[model samples]
Target: MVPDPDLQLQMVIKALSETVSTAVDPGNKVAQEQLHLSIATLGMMRSRLPMTRRFYRALAQDALTLAKDLEEKTGQSGALTQAMNDVGQALTDPGIENEAIEQSRARLHEAITDHLAQIDKSLGTVARDIVMQGSLGSIERQRAWFVESGFEPNADRIPAISELIQTPDHP
Candidate 1:
Protein backbone atom coordinates (compact mmCIF):
# COMPACT_ATOMS: atom_id res chain seq x y z
CA MET A 1 0.00 0.00 0.00
CA VAL A 2 1.11 3.51 -0.74
CA PRO A 3 1.82 5.45 2.42
CA ASP A 4 0.13 8.84 2.66
CA PRO A 5 2.75 11.51 2.13
CA ASP A 6 1.98 13.44 5.30
CA LEU A 7 1.94 10.27 7.34
CA GLN A 8 5.20 9.20 5.81
CA LEU A 9 6.78 12.50 6.72
CA GLN A 10 5.50 12.22 10.29
CA MET A 11 7.00 8.75 10.56
CA VAL A 12 10.34 9.99 9.31
CA ILE A 13 10.35 12.88 11.76
CA LYS A 14 9.47 10.65 14.65
CA ALA A 15 12.16 8.16 13.76
CA LEU A 16 14.75 10.88 13.38
CA SER A 17 13.77 12.42 16.70
CA GLU A 18 14.26 9.08 18.41
CA THR A 19 17.60 8.53 16.72
CA VAL A 20 18.93 11.90 17.73
CA SER A 21 17.65 11.48 21.25
CA THR A 22 19.08 7.99 21.86
CA ALA A 23 20.94 6.37 19.00
CA VAL A 24 23.61 9.00 18.32
CA ASP A 25 27.07 8.45 19.84
CA PRO A 26 27.23 10.48 23.01
CA GLY A 27 31.03 10.93 22.80
CA ASN A 28 30.81 12.30 19.29
CA LYS A 29 29.33 15.67 20.17
CA VAL A 30 29.52 17.00 16.66
CA ALA A 31 27.67 14.06 15.16
CA GLN A 32 25.00 14.29 17.83
CA GLU A 33 24.60 18.00 17.20
CA GLN A 34 24.36 17.50 13.47
CA LEU A 35 21.76 14.81 13.91
CA HIS A 36 19.73 17.11 16.14
CA LEU A 37 19.89 19.84 13.55
CA SER A 38 18.85 17.39 10.85
CA ILE A 39 15.86 16.33 12.88
CA ALA A 40 14.82 19.93 13.39
CA THR A 41 15.17 20.61 9.68
CA LEU A 42 13.04 17.59 8.86
CA GLY A 43 10.36 18.66 11.30
CA MET A 44 10.26 22.11 9.76
CA MET A 45 10.03 20.64 6.28
CA ARG A 46 7.18 18.38 7.35
CA SER A 47 5.22 21.33 8.67
CA ARG A 48 5.83 23.39 5.55
CA LEU A 49 5.26 20.72 2.89
CA PRO A 50 1.48 20.54 2.99
CA MET A 51 1.16 24.30 3.27
CA THR A 52 3.39 25.13 0.28
CA ARG A 53 0.53 25.73 -2.12
CA ARG A 54 -1.45 27.83 0.33
CA PHE A 55 1.65 29.82 1.23
CA TYR A 56 2.33 30.57 -2.42
CA ARG A 57 -1.30 31.50 -2.99
CA ALA A 58 -1.28 33.91 -0.06
CA LEU A 59 1.96 35.49 -1.30
CA ALA A 60 0.38 35.86 -4.72
CA GLN A 61 -2.57 37.66 -3.15
CA ASP A 62 -0.24 39.94 -1.20
CA ALA A 63 1.73 40.69 -4.35
CA LEU A 64 -1.49 41.41 -6.20
CA THR A 65 -2.57 43.82 -3.49
CA LEU A 66 0.78 45.62 -3.64
CA ALA A 67 0.71 45.70 -7.44
CA LYS A 68 -2.76 47.18 -7.46
CA ASP A 69 -1.78 49.82 -4.96
CA LEU A 70 1.32 50.75 -6.95
CA GLU A 71 -0.56 50.79 -10.24
CA GLU A 72 -3.15 53.17 -8.80
CA LYS A 73 -0.36 55.51 -7.72
CA THR A 74 1.62 55.40 -10.92
CA GLY A 75 -1.37 55.32 -13.31
CA GLN A 76 0.79 53.24 -15.66
CA SER A 77 -0.69 50.21 -17.44
CA GLY A 78 1.89 47.77 -18.76
CA ALA A 79 3.90 45.01 -17.05
CA LEU A 80 2.24 45.55 -13.70
CA THR A 81 -1.20 45.16 -15.22
CA GLN A 82 -0.18 41.97 -16.99
CA ALA A 83 1.45 40.62 -13.86
CA MET A 84 -1.70 41.27 -11.85
CA ASN A 85 -3.79 39.48 -14.44
CA ASP A 86 -1.42 36.53 -14.45
CA VAL A 87 -1.52 36.14 -10.68
CA GLY A 88 -5.32 36.50 -10.65
CA GLN A 89 -5.59 33.75 -13.21
CA ALA A 90 -3.23 31.51 -11.25
CA LEU A 91 -5.25 31.99 -8.09
CA THR A 92 -8.49 31.06 -9.83
CA ASP A 93 -7.12 27.75 -11.11
CA PRO A 94 -8.07 25.10 -8.56
CA GLY A 95 -5.66 22.58 -10.09
CA ILE A 96 -2.87 24.97 -10.94
CA GLU A 97 0.58 23.37 -10.83
CA ASN A 98 3.19 24.60 -8.34
CA GLU A 99 5.50 25.84 -11.09
CA ALA A 100 2.78 28.03 -12.57
CA ILE A 101 1.90 29.52 -9.19
CA GLU A 102 5.56 30.26 -8.44
CA GLN A 103 6.10 31.83 -11.83
CA SER A 104 3.05 34.02 -11.45
CA ARG A 105 4.06 35.06 -7.94
CA ALA A 106 7.60 35.88 -9.08
CA ARG A 107 6.32 37.95 -12.00
CA LEU A 108 3.98 39.93 -9.79
CA HIS A 109 6.68 40.56 -7.19
CA GLU A 110 9.16 41.64 -9.88
CA ALA A 111 6.60 43.94 -11.45
CA ILE A 112 5.87 45.50 -8.08
CA THR A 113 9.58 45.97 -7.39
CA ASP A 114 10.20 47.56 -10.80
CA HIS A 115 7.25 49.86 -10.38
CA LEU A 116 8.39 50.88 -6.92
CA ALA A 117 11.92 51.54 -8.17
CA GLN A 118 10.56 53.81 -10.85
CA ILE A 119 8.46 55.71 -8.30
CA ASP A 120 11.28 55.69 -5.66
CA LYS A 121 11.23 58.75 -3.33
CA SER A 122 7.85 59.92 -4.64
CA LEU A 123 6.02 56.93 -3.05
CA GLY A 124 3.26 58.20 -0.78
CA THR A 125 2.56 57.08 2.75
CA VAL A 126 -0.29 54.79 1.70
CA ALA A 127 1.88 52.90 -0.77
CA ARG A 128 4.71 52.63 1.70
CA ASP A 129 2.35 51.29 4.31
CA ILE A 130 0.95 48.69 1.94
CA VAL A 131 4.45 47.51 1.00
CA MET A 132 5.56 47.38 4.62
CA GLN A 133 2.45 45.46 5.60
CA GLY A 134 3.10 42.81 2.99
CA SER A 135 6.77 42.55 3.93
CA LEU A 136 6.07 42.23 7.64
CA GLY A 137 3.39 39.63 7.05
CA SER A 138 5.77 37.58 4.95
CA ILE A 139 8.52 37.81 7.55
CA GLU A 140 6.16 36.81 10.33
CA ARG A 141 4.93 33.85 8.35
CA GLN A 142 8.48 32.71 7.71
CA ARG A 143 9.43 33.10 11.34
CA ALA A 144 6.43 31.05 12.33
CA TRP A 145 7.59 28.25 10.07
CA PHE A 146 11.14 28.36 11.39
CA VAL A 147 10.40 29.02 15.07
CA GLU A 148 11.50 25.53 16.03
CA SER A 149 14.96 26.39 14.75
CA GLY A 150 15.42 28.52 17.87
CA PHE A 151 16.30 31.55 15.79
CA GLU A 152 13.69 34.02 16.96
CA PRO A 153 14.04 35.42 20.48
CA ASN A 154 10.43 36.61 20.42
CA ALA A 155 8.98 33.55 18.73
CA ASP A 156 5.85 33.86 20.85
CA ARG A 157 4.80 36.88 18.84
CA ILE A 158 4.88 34.92 15.61
CA PRO A 159 1.54 33.63 14.44
CA ALA A 160 0.91 29.90 14.45
CA ILE A 161 1.78 28.03 11.26
CA SER A 162 -1.85 27.09 10.74
CA GLU A 163 -2.90 30.71 11.08
CA LEU A 164 -0.30 31.85 8.56
CA ILE A 165 -1.14 29.10 6.07
CA GLN A 166 -4.90 29.60 6.31
CA THR A 167 -4.80 33.20 5.13
CA PRO A 168 -8.19 34.74 4.27
CA ASP A 169 -6.94 35.50 0.79
CA HIS A 170 -7.14 31.80 -0.13
CA PRO A 171 -9.74 29.11 0.53
Candidate 2:
Protein backbone atom coordinates (compact mmCIF):
# COMPACT_ATOMS: atom_id res chain seq x y z
CA MET A 1 0.00 0.00 0.00
CA VAL A 2 1.16 3.50 -0.78
CA PRO A 3 1.96 5.77 2.14
CA ASP A 4 -0.07 8.95 2.02
CA PRO A 5 2.20 11.92 1.23
CA ASP A 6 0.46 14.11 3.79
CA LEU A 7 0.91 11.52 6.51
CA GLN A 8 4.56 11.07 5.56
CA LEU A 9 5.08 14.79 5.95
CA GLN A 10 3.43 14.76 9.35
CA MET A 11 5.62 11.87 10.42
CA VAL A 12 8.73 13.69 9.31
CA ILE A 13 7.70 16.83 11.15
CA LYS A 14 7.00 14.89 14.34
CA ALA A 15 10.30 13.04 14.16
CA LEU A 16 12.22 16.23 13.53
CA SER A 17 10.50 17.96 16.44
CA GLU A 18 11.25 15.05 18.73
CA THR A 19 14.92 14.95 17.71
CA VAL A 20 15.32 18.72 18.12
CA SER A 21 13.75 18.69 21.54
CA THR A 22 15.85 15.82 22.87
CA ALA A 23 19.15 16.00 21.06
CA VAL A 24 19.78 19.65 20.22
CA ASP A 25 21.73 21.59 22.81
CA PRO A 26 19.75 24.51 24.17
CA GLY A 27 22.88 26.55 24.81
CA ASN A 28 24.14 26.05 21.26
CA LYS A 29 22.74 29.16 19.61
CA VAL A 30 23.53 28.07 16.04
CA ALA A 31 21.93 24.63 16.26
CA GLN A 32 18.96 26.01 18.12
CA GLU A 33 18.44 28.75 15.53
CA GLN A 34 18.72 26.24 12.67
CA LEU A 35 16.29 23.92 14.40
CA HIS A 36 13.81 26.75 14.89
CA LEU A 37 14.01 27.70 11.22
CA SER A 38 13.63 24.06 10.17
CA ILE A 39 10.57 23.61 12.35
CA ALA A 40 8.99 26.77 10.95
CA THR A 41 9.69 25.64 7.43
CA LEU A 42 8.14 22.26 8.12
CA GLY A 43 5.13 23.92 9.70
CA MET A 44 4.59 26.03 6.60
CA MET A 45 4.87 22.94 4.41
CA ARG A 46 2.37 21.10 6.61
CA SER A 47 -0.08 23.95 6.26
CA ARG A 48 0.25 24.01 2.50
CA LEU A 49 0.22 20.24 1.79
CA PRO A 50 -3.56 19.80 1.74
CA MET A 51 -4.08 22.87 -0.44
CA THR A 52 -1.62 21.81 -3.15
CA ARG A 53 -4.18 20.03 -5.32
CA ARG A 54 -6.73 22.81 -5.05
CA PHE A 55 -4.13 25.47 -5.78
CA TYR A 56 -2.88 23.75 -8.91
CA ARG A 57 -6.43 22.94 -10.07
CA ALA A 58 -7.46 26.56 -9.75
CA LEU A 59 -4.34 27.76 -11.55
CA ALA A 60 -4.98 25.30 -14.34
CA GLN A 61 -8.55 26.59 -14.61
CA ASP A 62 -7.31 30.18 -14.81
CA ALA A 63 -4.90 29.29 -17.57
CA LEU A 64 -7.67 27.56 -19.51
CA THR A 65 -9.89 30.60 -19.18
CA LEU A 66 -7.16 32.94 -20.33
CA ALA A 67 -6.28 30.71 -23.26
CA LYS A 68 -9.92 30.50 -24.39
CA ASP A 69 -10.38 34.24 -24.05
CA LEU A 70 -7.24 34.95 -26.05
CA GLU A 71 -8.28 32.51 -28.74
CA GLU A 72 -11.70 34.11 -29.03
CA LYS A 73 -10.34 37.64 -29.22
CA THR A 74 -7.54 36.86 -31.66
CA GLY A 75 -9.39 34.30 -33.81
CA GLN A 76 -6.20 32.31 -33.78
CA SER A 77 -5.02 28.76 -33.27
CA GLY A 78 -1.78 26.80 -32.96
CA ALA A 79 0.16 26.40 -29.75
CA LEU A 80 -2.68 27.86 -27.77
CA THR A 81 -5.11 25.24 -29.04
CA GLN A 82 -2.74 22.40 -28.26
CA ALA A 83 -2.02 23.72 -24.78
CA MET A 84 -5.70 24.21 -24.08
CA ASN A 85 -6.52 20.69 -25.24
CA ASP A 86 -3.76 19.19 -23.10
CA VAL A 87 -4.77 21.13 -20.00
CA GLY A 88 -8.45 20.35 -20.56
CA GLN A 89 -7.57 16.68 -20.64
CA ALA A 90 -5.50 16.97 -17.49
CA LEU A 91 -8.25 18.83 -15.64
CA THR A 92 -10.89 16.28 -16.53
CA ASP A 93 -8.97 13.43 -14.92
CA PRO A 94 -10.73 12.76 -11.60
CA GLY A 95 -7.62 11.23 -10.01
CA ILE A 96 -5.11 13.65 -11.51
CA GLU A 97 -2.05 14.11 -9.32
CA ASN A 98 -1.09 17.57 -8.06
CA GLU A 99 2.23 17.36 -9.90
CA ALA A 100 0.43 16.62 -13.16
CA ILE A 101 -1.86 19.58 -12.64
CA GLU A 102 1.13 21.82 -11.94
CA GLN A 103 2.84 20.59 -15.06
CA SER A 104 -0.28 21.27 -17.10
CA ARG A 105 -0.59 24.76 -15.68
CA ALA A 106 3.05 25.48 -16.55
CA ARG A 107 2.63 24.27 -20.10
CA LEU A 108 -0.54 26.28 -20.59
CA HIS A 109 1.04 29.34 -19.04
CA GLU A 110 4.03 29.02 -21.32
CA ALA A 111 1.81 28.81 -24.35
CA ILE A 112 -0.06 31.88 -23.20
CA THR A 113 3.23 33.72 -22.74
CA ASP A 114 4.40 32.76 -26.21
CA HIS A 115 1.06 33.77 -27.69
CA LEU A 116 1.24 37.12 -25.89
CA ALA A 117 4.69 37.69 -27.34
CA GLN A 118 3.41 37.06 -30.84
CA ILE A 119 0.45 39.35 -30.20
CA ASP A 120 2.73 42.07 -28.93
CA LYS A 121 4.75 41.82 -32.08
CA SER A 122 1.74 42.02 -34.39
CA LEU A 123 -1.29 43.35 -32.47
CA GLY A 124 0.43 45.63 -29.91
CA THR A 125 -1.62 47.40 -27.18
CA VAL A 126 -4.88 45.59 -27.85
CA ALA A 127 -3.36 42.24 -26.96
CA ARG A 128 -1.67 43.76 -23.96
CA ASP A 129 -4.95 45.07 -22.63
CA ILE A 130 -6.71 41.75 -23.06
CA VAL A 131 -3.89 39.81 -21.42
CA MET A 132 -3.63 42.20 -18.51
CA GLN A 133 -7.35 41.99 -17.81
CA GLY A 134 -7.42 38.22 -18.20
CA SER A 135 -4.39 37.70 -15.97
CA LEU A 136 -5.56 39.80 -13.01
CA GLY A 137 -7.30 36.92 -11.28
CA SER A 138 -4.18 34.78 -11.49
CA ILE A 139 -1.99 37.61 -10.29
CA GLU A 140 -4.31 38.20 -7.32
CA ARG A 141 -4.25 34.55 -6.37
CA GLN A 142 -0.44 34.46 -6.46
CA ARG A 143 -0.27 37.56 -4.29
CA ALA A 144 -2.67 35.98 -1.82
CA TRP A 145 -0.35 32.96 -1.57
CA PHE A 146 2.41 35.15 -0.15
CA VAL A 147 0.27 37.20 2.23
CA GLU A 148 1.65 35.29 5.20
CA SER A 149 5.19 36.52 4.56
CA GLY A 150 4.35 39.90 6.12
CA PHE A 151 5.69 41.83 3.18
CA GLU A 152 2.39 43.36 2.14
CA PRO A 153 1.79 46.59 4.01
CA ASN A 154 -1.96 46.20 3.55
CA ALA A 155 -2.04 42.52 4.33
CA ASP A 156 -5.25 42.94 6.29
CA ARG A 157 -6.96 44.28 3.18
CA ILE A 158 -6.02 41.17 1.22
CA PRO A 159 -8.17 38.07 1.40
CA ALA A 160 -6.81 35.04 3.20
CA ILE A 161 -5.03 32.46 1.05
CA SER A 162 -7.72 29.87 1.80
CA GLU A 163 -10.47 32.31 0.81
CA LEU A 164 -8.72 33.08 -2.45
CA ILE A 165 -8.23 29.39 -3.16
CA GLN A 166 -11.88 28.66 -2.43
CA THR A 167 -13.23 31.39 -4.72
CA PRO A 168 -16.66 30.54 -6.13
CA ASP A 169 -15.69 30.98 -9.77
CA HIS A 170 -12.97 28.35 -9.52
CA PRO A 171 -15.31 25.84 -7.91
Candidate 3:
Protein backbone atom coordinates (compact mmCIF):
# COMPACT_ATOMS: atom_id res chain seq x y z
CA MET A 1 0.00 0.00 0.00
CA VAL A 2 1.08 3.56 -0.58
CA PRO A 3 2.36 5.38 2.48
CA ASP A 4 0.18 8.12 3.92
CA PRO A 5 1.19 11.68 3.14
CA ASP A 6 0.42 12.87 6.66
CA LEU A 7 2.78 10.25 8.06
CA GLN A 8 5.34 11.38 5.52
CA LEU A 9 4.87 14.94 6.74
CA GLN A 10 5.28 13.80 10.31
CA MET A 11 8.51 12.08 9.36
CA VAL A 12 9.64 15.26 7.65
CA ILE A 13 8.93 17.38 10.69
CA LYS A 14 10.73 14.84 12.85
CA ALA A 15 13.70 14.86 10.50
CA LEU A 16 13.79 18.64 10.50
CA SER A 17 13.61 18.75 14.25
CA GLU A 18 16.39 16.19 14.66
CA THR A 19 18.60 17.93 12.14
CA VAL A 20 18.08 21.27 13.78
CA SER A 21 18.59 19.83 17.21
CA THR A 22 21.85 18.08 16.33
CA ALA A 23 23.29 20.94 14.31
CA VAL A 24 26.90 21.83 15.17
CA ASP A 25 25.79 25.40 15.67
CA PRO A 26 22.11 25.52 16.57
CA GLY A 27 22.15 29.31 16.50
CA ASN A 28 22.91 29.62 12.79
CA LYS A 29 20.49 32.09 11.22
CA VAL A 30 20.49 30.48 7.76
CA ALA A 31 19.57 27.08 9.15
CA GLN A 32 16.87 28.69 11.19
CA GLU A 33 15.49 30.48 8.12
CA GLN A 34 15.36 27.26 6.08
CA LEU A 35 13.51 25.60 8.91
CA HIS A 36 11.16 28.54 9.10
CA LEU A 37 10.42 28.49 5.36
CA SER A 38 9.73 24.78 5.37
CA ILE A 39 7.35 25.06 8.27
CA ALA A 40 5.66 28.12 6.76
CA THR A 41 4.95 26.40 3.43
CA LEU A 42 3.69 23.36 5.29
CA GLY A 43 1.29 25.44 7.32
CA MET A 44 -1.56 25.37 4.78
CA MET A 45 -1.58 21.60 4.45
CA ARG A 46 -4.23 19.87 6.57
CA SER A 47 -3.67 16.48 8.09
CA ARG A 48 -5.40 13.42 6.70
CA LEU A 49 -5.19 12.00 10.20
CA PRO A 50 -7.66 13.31 12.74
CA MET A 51 -5.22 13.24 15.66
CA THR A 52 -2.76 15.86 14.55
CA ARG A 53 -2.58 19.36 15.91
CA ARG A 54 -2.23 22.29 13.55
CA PHE A 55 1.48 22.58 12.64
CA TYR A 56 2.32 25.98 14.03
CA ARG A 57 0.63 25.28 17.32
CA ALA A 58 2.48 22.01 17.64
CA LEU A 59 5.73 23.73 16.86
CA ALA A 60 5.04 26.43 19.38
CA GLN A 61 3.84 24.01 22.03
CA ASP A 62 6.78 21.71 21.52
CA ALA A 63 9.25 24.60 21.39
CA LEU A 64 10.23 23.62 17.86
CA THR A 65 11.56 26.03 15.26
CA LEU A 66 8.98 28.70 14.59
CA ALA A 67 8.22 29.70 11.00
CA LYS A 68 8.56 33.42 10.43
CA ASP A 69 6.68 33.56 7.12
CA LEU A 70 3.94 31.39 8.56
CA GLU A 71 3.81 33.65 11.58
CA GLU A 72 3.51 36.71 9.34
CA LYS A 73 0.76 35.08 7.32
CA THR A 74 -1.21 34.11 10.41
CA GLY A 75 -1.44 37.52 12.02
CA GLN A 76 -4.90 36.66 13.25
CA SER A 77 -4.32 33.00 12.30
CA GLY A 78 -7.73 32.55 10.67
CA ALA A 79 -6.58 29.60 8.58
CA LEU A 80 -5.22 27.96 11.66
CA THR A 81 -8.26 29.14 13.53
CA GLN A 82 -10.62 27.60 10.99
CA ALA A 83 -8.52 24.45 11.02
CA MET A 84 -8.73 24.16 14.77
CA ASN A 85 -12.45 24.67 14.65
CA ASP A 86 -12.97 22.13 11.89
CA VAL A 87 -10.81 19.40 13.36
CA GLY A 88 -11.86 20.07 16.92
CA GLN A 89 -15.49 19.79 16.01
CA ALA A 90 -14.87 16.65 14.01
CA LEU A 91 -12.86 14.84 16.64
CA THR A 92 -15.16 15.77 19.45
CA ASP A 93 -18.16 14.25 17.76
CA PRO A 94 -18.20 10.78 19.32
CA GLY A 95 -20.38 9.32 16.59
CA ILE A 96 -18.30 10.57 13.66
CA GLU A 97 -17.46 7.96 11.05
CA ASN A 98 -15.43 8.14 7.86
CA GLU A 99 -18.69 8.56 5.97
CA ALA A 100 -19.67 11.52 8.08
CA ILE A 101 -16.23 12.99 7.60
CA GLU A 102 -16.62 12.53 3.85
CA GLN A 103 -19.88 14.45 3.98
CA SER A 104 -18.16 17.22 5.91
CA ARG A 105 -15.44 17.27 3.28
CA ALA A 106 -18.08 17.65 0.60
CA ARG A 107 -19.66 20.57 2.40
CA LEU A 108 -16.27 22.18 2.92
CA HIS A 109 -15.58 21.75 -0.77
CA GLU A 110 -18.81 23.54 -1.65
CA ALA A 111 -17.99 26.25 0.85
CA ILE A 112 -14.62 26.76 -0.76
CA THR A 113 -16.22 26.95 -4.18
CA ASP A 114 -18.71 29.53 -3.01
CA HIS A 115 -15.98 31.53 -1.31
CA LEU A 116 -13.85 31.57 -4.46
CA ALA A 117 -16.81 32.62 -6.57
CA GLN A 118 -17.49 35.49 -4.21
CA ILE A 119 -13.87 36.58 -4.40
CA ASP A 120 -13.92 36.44 -8.20
CA LYS A 121 -17.12 38.49 -8.27
CA SER A 122 -15.68 41.02 -5.89
CA LEU A 123 -12.62 41.25 -8.04
CA GLY A 124 -14.83 41.82 -11.09
CA THR A 125 -16.53 44.67 -9.34
CA VAL A 126 -13.16 46.04 -8.34
CA ALA A 127 -11.92 45.77 -11.91
CA ARG A 128 -14.95 47.66 -13.19
CA ASP A 129 -14.43 50.35 -10.59
CA ILE A 130 -10.78 50.60 -11.52
CA VAL A 131 -11.63 51.08 -15.20
CA MET A 132 -14.38 53.60 -14.44
CA GLN A 133 -11.99 55.39 -12.14
CA GLY A 134 -9.36 55.28 -15.03
CA SER A 135 -6.59 52.66 -15.25
CA LEU A 136 -5.17 50.37 -17.95
CA GLY A 137 -3.12 48.17 -15.64
CA SER A 138 -5.62 47.15 -12.95
CA ILE A 139 -5.97 43.43 -13.60
CA GLU A 140 -2.39 42.69 -14.58
CA ARG A 141 -1.15 44.45 -11.52
CA GLN A 142 -3.69 42.72 -9.32
CA ARG A 143 -2.38 39.34 -10.46
CA ALA A 144 1.15 40.46 -9.73
CA TRP A 145 0.03 41.70 -6.37
CA PHE A 146 -1.51 38.32 -5.59
CA VAL A 147 1.83 36.65 -6.22
CA GLU A 148 3.57 39.27 -4.15
CA SER A 149 1.11 38.88 -1.35
CA GLY A 150 2.28 35.39 -0.23
CA PHE A 151 -0.02 33.45 -2.57
CA GLU A 152 1.44 30.51 -4.47
CA PRO A 153 0.21 31.91 -7.79
CA ASN A 154 1.76 29.07 -9.78
CA ALA A 155 0.99 26.15 -7.49
CA ASP A 156 -2.60 25.04 -6.90
CA ARG A 157 -3.95 28.53 -7.41
CA ILE A 158 -6.48 27.76 -10.12
CA PRO A 159 -7.33 30.01 -13.04
CA ALA A 160 -4.06 31.69 -12.29
CA ILE A 161 -4.21 35.43 -12.32
CA SER A 162 -1.51 35.22 -14.97
CA GLU A 163 -3.94 33.25 -17.12
CA LEU A 164 -6.73 35.65 -16.21
CA ILE A 165 -4.71 38.53 -17.63
CA GLN A 166 -5.44 37.44 -21.21
CA THR A 167 -9.19 37.39 -20.59
CA PRO A 168 -11.11 40.50 -21.66
CA ASP A 169 -12.78 41.15 -18.34
CA HIS A 170 -9.45 41.68 -16.59
CA PRO A 171 -8.29 44.34 -19.05
TM-score for all predictions? 0.81, 0.78, 0.27
lDDT of 3 by residue, 1-171 (tens): 355776677777777666754663657878777776775455424231332222112212211111122223223243433533453355446566655544443443344334334444535554344324332233333444344336654635533443433433312
lDDT of 2 by residue, 16-125 (tens): 88865679888999988888777767777777777777777788888888889888876676988999998999878888888988888898889888887776366666
Q: Model 2: how far is 112 from its true place, Å?
A: 1.5
| Model 1: colliding residue pairs | none
Residue 46 lDDT in model 1? 79
Task: Single out the weakest 10-residue window by summed lDDT for candidate 2.
Answer: 119-128
Return the candidate ranking by TM-score, descending. 1, 2, 3
Query: lDDT of all predictions, in order shown?
Result: 0.79, 0.79, 0.41
Off by over 4 Å in 1: 19-30, 124-127
Best of the two (1, 2) by TM-score: 1
Report the alpha-carbon TM-score of model 3 versus the true structure: 0.27
User: Clashes in model 3: which pairs?
Assistant: none
Would you list the clashing residue pairs of candidate 2?
none
Q: Over the stretch 17-74, how does candidate 1's per-residue lDDT look in tens digits?
A: 8754687778998988888887778778877888888877877777787777767766
lDDT of 2 at 6: 69
